[model samples]
Target: MKKTIYKKIHIIGSVGSGKTTLAKEISSLLGIPYYELDNVVWIRNKSGDIRRTEQEREEYLNSILQSDNWIIEGIHNEDWVSNCFQSADLIIFLDTNYLVRTYRIIKRFLKQKLRIEKANYKPTLDIFFKMFKWNRHFEEVGKVNFFNKYVVHKDKIKVINNAKCIKKYFN
Candidate 1:
C-alpha cells in the first residue's frame, strides 16, 4: 500500500461545496482524523447551538494543530483559522458551481430535516436560507480573497472543480 504524503490537510470552500464530505472521504483513505470547524465553533445541546468564545475556539483549534495528522474542513477563511492554512501540508479548495451548491444546500437541508442525513446543528428554515446567502457571499467575496491570500502557497493548494477532481486526488 502506498502511504499518503500529507499529514495535515485543510479543506475550505463555500457552504454545500462538499468540503466536509470530501474531508471525511480523504481522512478515511489516509487514516487521518477529521475535524469539522462547525464542531469547534458551536456546541450543540438540548436548547440549540451555543457559540464558543474566541479563546475556547482557538484552544480547541490549537489542540488539533498540535496533533501529528488531521483533516480539518470548514467554510471559515477568517483570521482565526489563518494558522491552519499556514500549517497545513495540503489545502483543498472546492470550487463547485453556484447552481450545484444551491441544489446541494436545499437537498442537504431536506435530508437533515427528514433525519436522512446527520448535521451538526438543527435544520431550521432560517439556517437553510442562510446557507444560500453564505454560498453567495463566498462566490462574491470570499473566493477571490481566499485565492489571493494563499497565492504564496500555491504549490500546496489544490482547487477541485468537480467530483472527478476530488477522486483524482486520492486515487
Candidate 2:
C-alpha cells in the first residue's frame, strides 16, 4: 500500500477528541514539527490562570504556518487558521464516540494530576466540567457548520470515527 504523505497537516476536533495525541503521533511518524493550538491560544501562568489574547494568538499561529512541515492541532477554525489550511496536505477531523472521548478526557485529567503527563497548564475539575460544554459545541456548532462553511478541500479531509482507525490511518 502506498503511504500517505502530508507535508502540512491540520487536526481539528472538539475537546477530548484526541486531536493533540493523534497530531503528535502523526508528526513523529512523518518527522514533522507538531504544534498544539491551545498553546498558541492561551498563555499559561504558574498560578493556573489561562489568559487568551487574539492578537497574540494570531502571531503565534502565523509563526507556525510559516514553517514548511507542521502538524497543527486545535479546535479553533477561524479565518487565520483557515488560511493556513489552504496549504495543508491533509486535514483530519476526529469524530470519535462521545463516551470514548469522555473517558479519554477523564483519563488525561487524572494523568495530568498525577504528573504523568504535563499539560501547558494544569487541568482542574472546573476544566473537566467544561468538557461537557465543549463536546456540545463540537457536535452542534463546530464540526458540521465549520466543515460546511470553511473546509474547502473535501478530497483531502479524513474523518476518523474511532481510536482504531486513528492508528490505522497513521500506520
- Which candidate number maximizes lDDT? 1
Query: What does candidate 2's lDDT look like per residue over 30-139, in tens digits?
Result: 89999887788777788775756778888888888889889998888777578667778888888888888778888888999999988776687888788878887788
Q: Candidate 2: worst 10 consecutive residues by lDDT?
A: 162-171
Query: How many steric overlaps does candidate 1 have?
Result: 0
Query: Candidate 2 — which residues are off by over 4 angstroms?
Result: 1-4, 49-52, 167-171
Q: Runs in model 1 with CA error above 4 Å? A: 1-4
Tens-digit lDDT track of model 1 for 17-131: 9988888888888899999999899877878889999999999999999999899999998889999999999999999999999999999999999999988888999999888
Clashing pairs in 1: none
Model 1 CA lDDT for position 55: 98
lDDT agreement with native, every candidate: 0.90, 0.81
Q: Clashing residue pairs in candidate 2, if any?
A: none
